[model samples]
Target: MFNSAVATLNAPPVSIVLNWKSSYDGANGALIDMSQAVPGYSAHPDILAALAKGASDPALARYGPVEGDPEFRSAYADHVSQLYNAKIDRNEVQITSGCNQAFVATVLALAGHGDRILMMRPCYFNHESTLGMLGVGIDYVDCDDDGGLLPNCASIDAAIGPQTRAIALVSPNNPAGSIYPAPLLADILALCQKRGIWLILDETYRDFMPLDMDVPHHLFAQDDWQSSLIQLYSFSKSYCLPGHRLGAIIAGHDVVAQLAKVIDNIQICAPRVAQHALTPMLTSMSSWRQENRERIAARATVFRTAMDDLPGWDLLSSGAYFGYVRHPFTGVGSRQLAETMARKAGVLVIPGAFFGAGQDGALRFAFANAGRDVIVKLADRLSSLTL
Candidate 1:
């Protein structure tokens, strides 16, 4: 009785991974779950305290502005402006329930069924699923073997067809964890501008960039940047507030106005409690968030070292919270291997096939969820795998 898009879509990755958990019987310390890229630690006490205060405020219990709390719009605008070193205004921001919603709303606003959205190979699976349900066509901008699907102007030009409406990219990308370079990002944006297509950038992991590479890109500094750019962000990762379901969209006033309609119809408004809670702490919590970034980066180093010693495993690309690994078995599909790994080795990872096609032999390690010591144990488990 379901629609073709929903029926044709693959099984949910998390559900598939969780199913494997039942067979797990490894004698190792405990299950080392590297599945979801959630925060490894608790939200900062200050944030929790703020949340409590916001929850206690009866004024926030009622419905909020569909455009979002005006105070948060202004705060997030200022946050992005200072963070990206670009001039921004509150009018450009629209709060959403999560970055996923930000993406869905933006995608619906810009394109319709049969319209094309150009994306990178081995993309975040949810983006693919969302487009599929909407009956939108997906075209690819291929990435190299090194990890990131950084598209040059020529590649992007070749990928664009008559139906292509936008190019969507995720940096510190999900599944692969490749961070796109600044110059390359600028070039792609320029191409999108020339083509008169929107460039939808999802920077959910921007906070976790390595210290030397703090700023992810410089697109916002360009003249008339908003006309061609639609940026998506998440306070969930940065603030450890995923349960709060808070995210934002950065676009021109016209785009924000359009998004208001989408948000009004879908969510009416993002969760009001979290919006009120975070409004006061957005600027104040930067140093704390920076400390968490450093911690995650350090965990990345531990994960990298562990992968290096594994006989058959190859680390393809790693950044932020994820590592895309090429498993040793040549002919085995990733789904079967992932299941076996979960059962025998007591390790949990998502098979690469869930991300996109031709990804049968790879796996995505959401390594940031595990601490340094747990990451070290990953090497031990894989080393013991007989396959």
Candidate 2:
């Protein structure tokens, strides 16, 4: 009566965390939620105005092209090309319902039931779950070390087997928030090119990178980079429009065409109203997005400072939107500690085990959504934990 594969999946991570948050209602203190990575800010007023206008436009009520709204495709491509200083065209980009959908479509197009995808350990759990349900082999290459969450070229090279079809990675990584250095990305890209395997780079948090960091990586500038690189992006974080569910993929024109078939069967096209609303803001709202980036950076700084003085906990990595910390408890698993924090301290965070194996002692805090005062209060609550 139901899909057995779906039954094997765990409950969604964010929802579980949200449930924990709900347990603290009317408690002694404010509940500080650091579970899900979502923008704390609202969409720009101008973007909101555009969305209202788009909603009222009767033309958008009809079905849109399966690929995307032509206006959105063109606008997004131009925006990406200008940001990366690369040669990108509308034909090379495909808009999807969200980054998750973009990833799903790419996986379906690139790998079959038994084929493998190399994922960095401490992966975004949704990616792992998606591959599991598809019966695609997930070969995890551990990125955790004294050096942090950056990919090791040697480890990544050794993980590739004949069945491996691609290497998937997320930067300003979801659980740890470690931004891979550009040189390391170059090395990984070269290795993929040599092996004739695809590099699926999920740059969902690219817009939140430090203002001084300028560009995320130089892979886009390489000759024929599209042959080895498939980049995924989300407008949700940058534009504060997660509810709109807009995301995209940038690849070779040929690959985009292949994605069209998978996407057509999935959602036909991304939401039309948001696509129409976002097309103009891609260029017009650049400065507003930059301000949001700075705001998140400030939050990251506050979290780092709060963790620095903690007696037992260790801040393993902090950037973009997350802070991965090793909990003080020696015997307790991460899930238990997370629950304890929620029920006892009114602070909610995701257990590290949700991200990958061998991570039972750590927890990931999505600190971007919490402001400085909330973060300070969170630190006080965490400090009060006896274990």
Candidate 3:
């Protein structure tokens, strides 16, 4: 027998979508995979060398601190402080196997069965499934395409119920890629404080924002910001090291102490080699990170231009690594259309239905997985879709 909560859920969306590839015979063209938000390029040579060096060190094979390597934590703290223009103590940071685990640990620490968490619709599927498995009820604030998929402050305030423990948000959101404005985030934090709930903000795609944009937010600068705010970030995307699976949690020291218990049981510590490898690179590779940021931004421009004036498809919202698009087929479900595109058109993407209910009319394009040339071919491939 399996746990009904998890057993009842659908298979992982990426794997499900990828299975349709078996039907493709390279008839259209080389398969342009836009299903997962993997970096289109290779990891920097220095990062790879560091990873190799760390792997060769026998000391790193053993377990390290449950929270994370002390040196890595301190380096990451300094990195965060510099970016946010605030002081973040190393003690307040907790490293996890990946951002997904960081989210899981935060949920485990903050909520339990019968408690509810408010999330925005078109939410990250992993977050939703994590709550479902833990028996935590989830309430969603539906975001409209017209609003660029940003949740309304009034709606968020209204959605907070007596049992709501925290509000989970993803900036440069997973499916929609809409960046939440700094002012709007502050208002939401104020709402969270007034309602006596936690604000779990996930900034996984923060490094890929438009180059002209300033800091993502000033929440970290506010007095006692740690008491109400817990921020999550991923090193995998920025470093192009998803295989290493490293991530972090920035919160009050006390919160980090509490999450340590969950981390101890889930993963004794994050990948030791990864921690040691990335610790120095956090500061040393700033220029490389900035260069990749520009690369991703340019890809976004190309993808946006490629989607323009497409007969029936509408690019509802796009930025960072993804584009949420509305397909023109009136009655066709997003999953069916995505599958068809993968098989006949040689393009792979995720169906919006995988994100949440009422998203069946749209699909999520992880444009960062393809280069400019491949992205440019999208229009032709999509235009070829008759169904």
Candidate 4:
């Protein structure tokens, strides 16, 4: 029998959204799928070659260190050190199957049954579900449209209870796509330190942030940062290799040692083939990553323009890979609207209700997978909807 906590949860959002596709008859046009946040483009040729070479090698098929491949961890540590202008040792890094697994391992290592983690409303669903199945409590502070969907440090500070073990957040957030400013992040980190709780920052989409923004934050450079901060990242979006399922955690050496126990029981180690293939490419693929960043930025601009002055749709906060939009129907729930849109308008998106409560009027459009032309056509499809 399944656990009640896990059994009571809603089905996976992406899988539910994809199932709606079965109702579409293609009457409107070619389906524009803005549901899942995957890179629209294919992996780089060099990366593909590396994967093939690594997969074919017999040695890479053996078990690796529970933390990760040594070369990959060192390569990633160097990459993080340069990016954050901070000192990071390879020993402080732990690679996992993906960012989701990274979160699971971090939670298992840091908190337990009845311990709470503070999260923003409209938080990533997977984070919520992960906590639920573990019997961990979740406390939320709402991030509204007026505040650009960023949580206030004072509000977060006030929400922390004695049992709260950590504050988990996603930058360039999943459903809202709102990037937290460095100063804001610093303020929140200070509050977390003051409260004696962990700050789990998920930076999965950091590589696609607008080019003009400064470094993500200076928290990594602070003395004793390792005591309170844990940063999570993914190689999937940046490298267009989600199927490879590679992610990492950068924390204190002690924290990494603790996580090794959790990860050892969870995965033994991340996929050896991916670790071997991506180790050198961390440095080698710099320019390629930058180019993709520019491409995503261009797509964001086009999406904004396409949504501008639309009769009912309001583009709330958009950047990175998503546009959080308020739909026209006032009383209709986003779940129903989203399904109707897919079947009639041939446009697929995730309902905001899936993200959290009080989100019935909104939809999360992951425009990263749609090209500019496809995005241009979105306005018309949406406009034609009568239901």
Candidate 5:
């Protein structure tokens, strides 16, 4: 039989959207998919060449170091430290199969059946479900819709209970791409430090933000940071390597050691070939990656313009890869409405309810995958929606 997490998640609603996308296939209808986190583009050619080299090496066929190959770990730690100006050593980082695995390891490291984790409402759905399946209590801190879905430190402060073990937040958030300003992030970090709880910050979308923006939160540079903070990341977005599935967690060396124990059973180690291959690129291909960031920023501009064309729909918050839009619909649920739109409008999207129950009034459009022309079609689709 399947587990409770499997039951609760009920398969990502994107699957249902995909089914509708399939049903509506036609040469006449436009197909713009904004449902999943998958990158619409491919990795750089030089990166592929490295992958080919790694694949052909007979030495890579064998099992790798469970902590991650030393070369990759060193490269990752150094890159993150230099970018964030955080003092991190190779021992403080643990490479995981991907961001999901990094999150799983962090949860396992910190909480259990009866312990609690505070999550912001309209959170990434998988975080809620993961804690639920573990029988860990997930308490939601209500975010103000008027202010955008950015986490308010006071609400977060109110959510911390005696049993609370940690707080989990995703910046350039999944459903709402609202970037929490550095001051707000610092406040949350201070609360966690005061309460002696962990702050699990998911920075998967951070790479897409304007690189010159002020700090990506100063939690990393704070004194005694490792004791109260655990940061998670995915190479999937930044490196355009989702299928390769490589990610990492940076915390105290002690916490890293604890997660290493969990990783022992969950994966034994991250995919050896990908980690080994990504090592050199992390160091050598900085400029290429920056160009990709600029490209995504351009796509964000196109999406903003497309949303501007659709007057009835409200473009709530656009950040990184996602645009959280409030459709003009009133009565119908987002799932049913999204399904109808997917078929009729010839575009696929994830309903807001999939992200969190009370989020039904909105929908998430992962606009980064589609280019300008494809995103422009969103206006037509919005105009066609009956709701």
Candidate 6:
């Protein structure tokens, strides 16, 4: 027999296969894959060389510091300090296998069985399942579709209850791509502080935000920022290293110390080879990374322009790597539509319903993985369909 919590998210699978199994006759079009949230590009040549060198050197095969390699940790801490203008030390950062593992550690650290964590509806499916499998009830704040999927502050304020232990949110959100404004974030933090709950802010797409946008928060500069905030990020998107399984957790030293225990049990430590390889890139390839950011931003623009006024299609929210669009089929379930799309339209995308407690009308497109040339085809693929 399966666990009850497992049954909750057993609700449905992403099913790129189930979709293609039926209609993949090699007829309509070659598959346009956009299912997974991974970098479609290659890793840095220097890092690839480093990985090769590490493979041959006999040095990187052993266990590493559970918190992380000191060199990589110090390098990343310095990187964080430079970006946020906050004086963070290596002691405040913990490397994990990936951002997913980082989220697991933070959730395990903050809440447990029968406890609850508030998240916005139409969330990252992984976040939803993580809580479901852990027996942590997910409390969802309904996102404002007309208002660009941003959570209404009052809803978050209203969602908190005695059983709520924390609030976790992905900014430049996975399905919606809505970036929380500074004032809105401050209010959320204040709300969390007043309610005595932790705030797990996932900034995985921070590197992809527009160059002109401000950093996500001022809390990094606060004296007690560590006490109330747990920040998560991925080196994968920024450095094209998801396969290397490297991510970092930024929290107060005490929280970092506790989560280190969970992380130690999780993956021993993050991939040290990748961590070390990224240190130099963080310092040396600023221009390349910024250029990559611009490239992804351009991809988002392509999706926006492509779907601008298609009948019954609505681009409700877009930013970072994702764009949430309302599908024209008003009565079709999103899960069914997602499958129909993958099979019929030759495009793979995540259903919005995968995101949260209530998401019936939208589908999420992570358009950044496609290059400009490939992105050009999306308009046609979308236009060709009559869902």
lDDT agreement of model 4 with the native: 0.94
Which residue runs of candidate 6 sit more than 4 Å off their true CA positions? 11-22
TM-score of 4: 0.99
lDDT (10s digit) by residue, model 5, range 1-387:
777555765665556678887766554366888988877788888788888888888888787777788989998999988888877899988999999889988999899888999998788987887887778898998676788878677778888999999999999788788898888888989999999999999999988886567457778888999889999999998788888889999889999889999999998888877887888888788888788788888888889998899877898888889999888788779898888877777778889888876888888999888887788777876785663
Please list the C-alpha lDDT of all candidates, in the order they appear. Answer: 0.90, 0.90, 0.93, 0.94, 0.85, 0.82
Name the candidate, 2 or 4, with the larger TM-score value: 4
For every candidate, C-alpha RMSD to the true structure in Å = 1.2, 1.1, 0.7, 0.7, 1.5, 1.8
Model 5 deviation from the true structure expressed as Cα RMSD, one decimal place = 1.5
The lDDT of model 2 is 0.90
Which stretches in model 2 have alpha-carbon errors above 4 Å? 25-28
Structural similarity to truth (TM-score) of each candidate: 0.98, 0.98, 0.99, 0.99, 0.96, 0.95
Compared with the true structure, what per-residue lDDT tens digits does model 6 show for residues 1-387?
878777655544555434455575545567777766777788779878877777665567788899998988899899999888889899999999989899999999888888999988788888888887888888888887777788877889899989999999898788788998877888888888888998999999998887687576677886688778999999889888778888999998899888988987777778867876777778898888888888888888887887774666899998999888888888888878877777777878887777765687888888887877776677777776766
Clashing pairs in 5: none
Clashing pairs for model 3 are none
What value does the lDDT take at residue 123 in candidate 4?
Answer: 85
Query: Model 6 compared with the native: what TM-score?
Result: 0.95
Backbone clashes for every candidate come to 0, 0, 0, 0, 0, 0
Model 6: per-residue Cα lDDT at residue 331? 86
